[model samples]
Target: MKKQLLVAVSLCAGFIASAMADSRVTIHYPGQSQALVLQGAANLEQLTLRPELNGRTWWPGTVIAERTASGIQQQTQQQTQQQLLARLSAFSAALRGDNDGELAGSVDRVRTQLAAMRVTGRQFVPLDPDWIRLHAEANRRLSGEYSVYTLSRPTSVQVVGVTTPAGPQPYQPGRDVAEYLQTHQRLSGAEKNVVWVIQPDGKTEKVPVAYWNHRHVEVAPGSIIYVGFSSWSLPRAYRDVNEQIVSLLTHRIPD
Candidate 1:
């Protein structure tokens, strides 16, 4: 009788252990407060966003999974090929609609983004075969099997300063001074030797272009880029103008 009771207790514990092993993964959508908890092999196809956006698609974005005593815990995913194709399609459509010849330069920018994404741990990773595999492996390794992502638009950053044909211009994704100088006609005539990034925090950071590719540089949304001759090299009149332009173009955080 005691042997039978021991056997029953062992079976019950085994069931509880199996149940605990089958954990769920969490995914967060853009502009939403709540998160989705999925169990086992949650692929990109399983992800659905609310109030679908017209021109936006799901791109892998990082988020804080939880806040601990140590610091904020971040969750990320591997990139997929579908996201790349979607972005390329959008850029192609933009090129087709380019009546002003300005968008002709965007092709190279799109290619640059594709190139930068070749490596791992990129900021924006799409859901592809490899990504899904990685996601599964990650879930198996981590507790709670947590994952988070967001939807994003193609072009987030705005460009303004001396290089634009008009006053301000829009920069496509993955574009930097390297690609910008290649396509836009240089109007300043003073030699655009400096590239300045005006961040959302109202701070300026100088970006030096080593090659026309400038593969390592990127800017955030609403940030302004100033491309022009260095202020030190310019005459006082020109320097004042450049500073004023950069100052005015700076992005201000909402009060």
Candidate 2:
């Protein structure tokens, strides 16, 4: 009788262990989303999300950005893709004054980012696949899954001001913006030569500093938006926001 009881106990414990192992990976970024990505082969086809995001949620359809052992960039791409879908769904739902919980917050965050952009009128550019791939690559590197990444090269860092075109200008260290001031002391703000910068794209351009990208808008008359920058998309998954943003932005912009 004791042997049979021991066997029953062992079976119960084994069941519990299996249940725990089968639990989906939970990912959440407060104002973001709380869902599960199933544990399975990374190469699953039914879902666009990395192994973690495939079937863990009640998604209406396939999502984007499959996670990898690499960087959080996969999450960033997924965030953008999810935001896009949410926005479309939300707008249509407004006809009935309905708001889906998961999508509402995501769309709101996207709105806040857009409102912060200088080109307030410009709509959110559709998420690019190249951006998605680059994000995944960067995430892999930053997450230590990869040793490193070779940037395509710095392109242009265009600078603008409260009321001027700055016109695809070069990156300046101490001029328009002080974001990229380095240890080199040869350049001074008064020197027009000081603001010139070469970007990662192998394109020699002018700027006050190595501002990441060449797209920006002016905030009001005196306030300005830094150009050559990426849309600072929030990581919709659980991770460091600034770290993810900088990684995705500083990574080579998608081709």
Candidate 3:
């Protein structure tokens, strides 16, 4: 597949410097954990999806037929799956402070692995170079400070007035839904979920999956993102995965 558009958004709380030369990254994939030290100029594809990464498995003709349009055998089907998973994972990681997998390993793993495991409704998404850069910066930011900021000052958001398996829980807006799910693993397996944004002036808006993926849909201080159920699986499975992640920063699953 041809490369898609890449946007470089700087979400740093303060300061921007020249991109670093070399960086070490740890990628946690389903059934895999890859660690690589990379040059800033290195493209993500080098580490993610390549013929070698799959270990000498040539593209199955049928898998190619489904993924490529007509003459785009440049990349294989497995490569595509890996690319999409990486993008989804990075976005989910950004939601609540730095509790990427730790806060919700069980739930996040389900979301990450299931999306990779699905047969139909799969699409290849180009790796977001900016995401890698942002991650590197976040890592560097943490290294300079004596203590990580996540511990000193917590990072969280609120979901107001939502019913759950526990029933009528208070809308305490201090923890990101992703972080909440990490500790409360009981509510992870629900099949369907929806996302709602509570505006500043007592207004509410339902955000579509596409809207959430756009870099423009940033979460502000008082904005409330609440996930509700529409169905077991979303219109597009990737959409379900993406929404689940954004909802982790702003989700509400009912029991």
Tens-digit per-residue lDDT, 1-255, candidate 3:
123222233423122433332223322122233422222322343433333223322111101111223323223433455555675455445533454343234335444433533222212222333343466532222111010000111133344312232212223455333332222223332322334664322235554433244222344334445544334322244456544433332211111
Candidate 2 lDDT tens digits, 1-255: 999999999999987766543322224321343443344222222123443343333221111232346535455554554444454345435523553443333434333443232110111221222344556542221111111111122233433211123323343433334432332222111122223232222122333333454322211111122222122322234223323222222222221
Q: Model 2 off-target regions past 4 Å? A: 25-255
> Candidate 3 at residue 89, lDDT?
59
TM-score of each: 0.34, 0.22, 0.21
- What lDDT score belongs to each candidate, Candidate 1 first? 0.43, 0.31, 0.32
Higher-ranked by lDDT: 1 or 3: 1
lDDT, candidate 2, at 73? 49
lDDT of 2: 0.31
Relative to the unseen true structure, what is the C-alpha lDDT of residue 126 in candidate 3, on a scale of 0 to 100?
A: 25
Measured with C-alpha atoms, the lDDT of residue 92 in candidate 1 is: 44
Candidate 1 per-residue C-alpha lDDT over 12-52 given as tens digits, one digit per residue, 9 for 90 to 100: 99877666654455555656779676663333333322223
lDDT of 3: 0.32
Q: Who wins the lDDT comparison?
A: 1
| Model 1 per-residue lDDT at 42 | 31
Angstrom error of the Cα, residue 229, model 2: value is 11
